[model samples]
Target: MILCCGEALIDMIPAKTEDAGTGFVPHSGGSVFNTAIALGRLGTRAGMLTGLSRDLFGRQLDDALKASHVDTRTVVYSDRPATLAFVQLEAGHATYTFYDENSANRMLAPEDVGALPEDVLALYFGGISLCNPPAADTYLELAERHAGRCAIMLDPNIRPSFISDIPAYRARIARMLAVADIVKVSDEDLGWLYPGPEALMEKLAALLKAGPSVAIMTRGGSGATAYLRDGREISVAAEPAQVVDTVGAGDTFNAGVLAKASELGLLTPGGLAEAGEAEISDVLAFGAKVAAVTVSRAGANPPWREELAQERPPA
Candidate 1:
């Protein structure tokens, strides 16, 4: 099973009301939450570990997970209110106004990160959950605890507005990157992490030196490029799709990469470390394809496994 560790929250998206005015409609989402849902829908053995309130929104989130077949046994329950992000879409891109102070996910403690079951093969960490205080430290602790026990993937999914202390967050990211087996970053994230006159490949090389065996850089429409620790760089064109809203595109992409890697038996620490160019290419292609399906839909909804059966390349 692949365990995704991070925030689970409600995304309040704008929609036309019966009265013809725009109103916010609640959707179950968060970076890690979306990835878990996508993985489950893709027929992967996926589980989620995060803080969830017992409120209506939390129950909604629970139902969404179960409906998508994501294991919720590791969720920490609380009476604290669930986090809410009111989304505004402009030209197929999404921006959020978060109301997360004192919310359930924001208050997650290190003790909440319990022991992992033996079935777990890989762990994924990312999102705004990596920005806040106790929760961020808690996730870092989780990664530290299970660093070498299983393959670990990190995608900072950087949101600058949420970061209060840039230097401190940078330091935290550096530490987490050191233990990550796979690290995925966007061009914007790269600019934030290593701002200067340095070239893109140089930044990726520095990222590889930090620790990950594989470093992936995604450019929204242009494409994505993967840099291996052994100095092999593989690039693939972006899968074509009619854009709806780019909310969970990256998260679903991460899930696709993990699911394909798991199917290829390359999700284990040793397997990922020894993966060749062909294995990496296959994994990345699937990720791009899955993400294309995601961006073609409304909100963060990802395709079910059967939805892509016809599109799957022959074994």
Candidate 2:
């Protein structure tokens, strides 16, 4: 079992290109939420930890999670309104404008997590959940408590527009990375977080020193690279496809990596830190393939097991 902790919100996206002129549509989204749903859809035993509202949009988000087979038992229901994010496509990449102040997800408390199941193989977290106060603290507490019990994966999903204090944000991200066994960030994120390549490598090495055994840096179409603490690195190119919208692509890729690791029986507490370069390469390749399929289609819809199986040819 894998536990995903963070916000779950409704994405108001462009529906029709002609009617709306901007072509906006609404979809169930949130970085952690998308990862959990993708894991469930891939037939992995996954659960989500976040606050949900009683409103219609929240109901739709809950229904979508259920449809994706995610365990919602750990989700907390609140009277506050659900978080909303407006997603727009710019240069084929999804840019988000979020409105999460006083939202249900932003109101998550430490008590909401309670005691996690011993069977949980890993804990994944990211997004605006780390930006908020009490909730961010709650997640940090949980990560520290379970640091030795299960593998922890963290993705900051850095968006400078939403972050007011860069230093505080960097500190918070650094704190999370200290407890994470695996950290994923985009090349753009690295550039934004640390300006120059030399500075980026220095900072990345500092993060690796914080206990993450593996750090992955994704470079959009250029591909992704993974650095192991043991001094080994490997890179893979992204599969070329007709891009529709890049929304949720990275989140789904994270899911694919975790799913593949789970399939290889490497997501357990002790397995993550010991996973070799070869194993990590396979995981990234699988993730990149899955993400390629997602980007080929419209919206944040990820591929199911059957869909992926059909795409894979027999050896």
Candidate 3:
């Protein structure tokens, strides 16, 4: 089973153009939440481990997860308000302004992680959960404790504006990377976190030394690259599609990687490390295809199993 741990919140996306000056449209989002939902939709046995609010937005989020067949038995609902992110889309990309300080998800503590299922095959984490304090510490602790038992995947969907202390945030992420077996990051994220592309290979090499066996760097429509610790690199180009919006594209990509790995029974702690280049390439291509489909749709909606099965390879 894939256990996704992180924030679960409501995204208040602008329903119309800024020139129209309209109210926001609500959608259930949160990096790990989206990944979990996508994994479930892709026929993986996925479950969520996070804090939710008792508000209407939270209810909607739960209902959406249920609709996607994600297990919510590990979710903790609190009296505190749900976290909110205002999404503004421009040129197919989303700019988020979060209103999450002191929200329910931010208040998650180490105790909450104790409820995680014991038989979990892989634990997925990322996003703003590593930005905060007690919750961040809790996630790190869980990652360390379970690192030997299950494969750990991390997607540090970094947004620098939300991070106040860059050094500290990088330190926390380094710790998480030390335990993660699979680390998926974006080209934009690497530029912000490490600066120039010249330093990328060095930085990724350093990350591989930490623990992760495979590090994936996504370049949006240009496609993605995977660097294996064994000195192998494979690249895949994104499939072409009519653009809709890029919301959840990365999360869906994460889901695709995990789902494909799970389907091939490679989600075990060391299984991914030993996977051949051909195997890795196939999985990465599948993920990129899934992301392409998601960007061709609206909101965080990802392709179901049938949709993926019918997708043609990128030309």
Candidate 4:
């Protein structure tokens, strides 16, 4: 199973009311939540590890996960309110203003996290969870402690504004990159992570040297590339789709990658370390395809199993 560890929150998406006036509609979302939902919809055995409240929004988030077939057994509950991300979409692109102070997600401490079940082969970590202080420290501890137990996938999804301590945040991320087996990053995230005249591939190379066996980099319209620590690289074109707001496109892309990895029996630490170019390339292509489906629709809706062709190879 792929265990996603992070925050679960409500995304107040821009919507049109009956009278045509713009309003915000609550959507069950958060980077990690979206990935878990996408993975479940894609038929992967996925679970979420986060703190949730008993509030209506939290209940909605819980129901959304159960509806998508993601396991919520590992979820920790609190009485605090849910985090709210008010989204702003301009021309099918999305940005966010998050209100997370003292929310359930932000209050997670290392002690609040429980033990993982034995079946979890990979842990997916990233998003704003790494930006929030106590929760950030909690997840970092979990990831660091579990690094030897299973494979790790991380996508910083860097939001500079959310980070209050640049140096500490960098230190945490640097430690995580060293332990992660697979690291997915965006061009913008790379620029923010290692700003300067370093070429894109150079930055990718540095990431590989840091520790991850495979580094995947996505360039919004240009497609994505997978780089191996031993110097192999594979690139895939983004599947075409009618553009809608790109809310969970990247998150679903992550789900697709994990789903394919699980299907291919490459969801293990050893599998990731020994993965070949063709397999990693196929995973990236699958991710791009899934992201296409997401961007073709409004909101963060990922494709169900019926919407896509078979992913598993014939026995």
Candidate 5:
């Protein structure tokens, strides 16, 4: 099982009312939540680890997880209100305004977290959970605790606006990258982390030196590229799709990479370190295909395994 540790919240997306005026409608979403749901939909044994409120929105989040086949055993329930993100879309791209002060998911402390199950072979950490305090430190502690026992994949999903203290957040991210086995970053994220005249690949190399065995750089529309610590690199083109909204495109792409890697028995730290070029290329390609499906639709919805053709080799 791949355990996803982070915040789960509601996305208040704008919709046209009967009268034609725009009104917001709630949708179950969060970066980690979307990835967990995508993994479950792709038939991966996925579980969620985060603080959830007992409120209506929280219940909706829980139901959505189970409906997508994500295990909720590791969830921590509370009476606090759930976090919410008010979304604004333009030309199929999304921007969020968060309402998370004192919310259930943001109040998680290190003590609130528990031990991992023996079946969890990998742990994924990212989203706004890494951008806020208390919960940010909480998730990092959990990842650090289980770093070597299982594979650790991180996608900071960097949102500059969410970060209050740039230096402190950079330090935290540095520590996270040090312990992570695989790290994914977008071109914008890379630039933000290492701003200068250095090229994108050069910045990625600096990230590889931080400790992760593999670094994946995603280029919107242009596709993604993966780099190994030993200098091997693989790039894949983005799969064609009728773009609707890029809401959960990156999140679903992450699930696709992990799901395919796990399916190929390459989800372990050592396994990823020794993975071949063909295997890595296949993983990146699968991720692109999965993400293509997500961007071709509305919201953060990911495809079920049955929705795609059988492309994996026999186990």
Candidate 6:
């Protein structure tokens, strides 16, 4: 099973109400939540680990996870309110105003990261969960605990504005990178992490040296490239889709790659390190295809098994 760690919050997506005035509609979303849903829909054994509230919105979020077939066995419960993000869209791009202070997810601490079952072969980390407070430190501690021994995949979906202490965040991320087996980062994230005239390849190489066996970089619209620690690189073009919104594209892409890798039994420490170019190429292609289905629609809704049943590659 693939265990996804982080936030599970409501996204107040902008919508046109029947009254014609614009209003926000609540949708169960968060970077890590989206990936877990995508993974479950892709027919992977996925579960979520995060802090949830006993509030109505929290129940709603819980229902969404259960409906998605994402295991909630590892969830931590609280009486706190849920985190809410008010989203604004302009020319199909999205921006957010988060109401996360004192929220259930934000209140999570290091002690809340409970133990996992033996079936959970890999742990996936990312989202604002790694940027926000006590939760970020909690998740980092979890990553540090499992580091080189477990199959770990990280995507620090960078949100520079959300970080209050850049130095601490950077240092923490560098520490996590040291033991990650697979890392999925965007070109924009690379720029933010290591600013200046340094070429993209240089930054990626630095990440590889820190420890990941596979470094995957996604370039919006253009495509994504996978760099193996062994010096092999494979690039795949982004699948075409009528532009709707790009909210969950990257998260779903990570899920897609992981789904394919897990299917091939490559979501393990040794498998990732020993994977060949062909194996990595197939994973990237699957990710691009799955992400295409996500961006072709509205909100962070990912493809369901029935919707993309035929898209599944042979195991």
- TM-score for each model: 0.97, 0.93, 0.94, 0.97, 0.98, 0.96
Across 1-315, the per-residue lDDT of candidate 2 in tens digits comes to: 899999899999866675556665678999999999998988888999899999998898899999999988888898889999998778777888899888888878887767776677799989888876677778888888888778899998887787756677777777788788888987667676667657777867866887688888887777788887877788888988799888889998999889888888888654755777788788888888888888888877888988875445322
Q: Candidate 6, after superposition: displacement of residue 110 in Å?
A: 1.8
- List lDDT for all candidates, in order: 0.91, 0.83, 0.86, 0.90, 0.92, 0.88
Worst 10 residues of 4 by lDDT: 306-315
TM-score of predicted model 2? 0.93
Off by over 4 Å in 5: 310-313
Runs with alpha carbons beyond 4 Å of true place in candidate 3: 17-19, 309-315
Weakest ten-residue segment in model 1 by summed lDDT: 306-315
Best by TM-score: 5
- Model 5 residue 87 distance off true place after TM-score fit, in angstroms: 0.7
- Tell me the tens digit of each residue's lDDT in model 1 across 58-98: 99999999999999888999999999999999998999889
Best by lDDT: 5
Model 5, 1-315: lDDT tens digits are 999999899999999999999999999999999999999999999999999999999999999999999999999999999999999999998999999988899999988877778899999999899987899999888888888988999999999898877888999999999999999999888899899999877898899999899999998789988888888888999999999999999999999999999988999986777988888888999999999999999999999988888565447
Residue-level lDDT of model 4, residues 1-315, one tens digit each, is 899999899999988999989999999999999999999998889999999999999999999999999999899988999999999999988889999999899899998888889888899999999996899999999999999688899999998888879999999999999889899999889888889899987888788888788888988778998888777778999998889889999999999899988888898775755888788888889999899999998899999978887545425
TM-score of 1: 0.97
Superposition-based RMSD of candidate 1 using all C-alpha atoms, in angstroms = 1.4
Report clash pairs, candidate 2.
13-24, 13-25, 14-23, 14-24, 14-25, 15-24, 15-25
Q: Model 3: how large is the Cα RMSD against the reference? A: 2.8
Using lDDT as the yardstick, the better of models 1 and 2 is 1
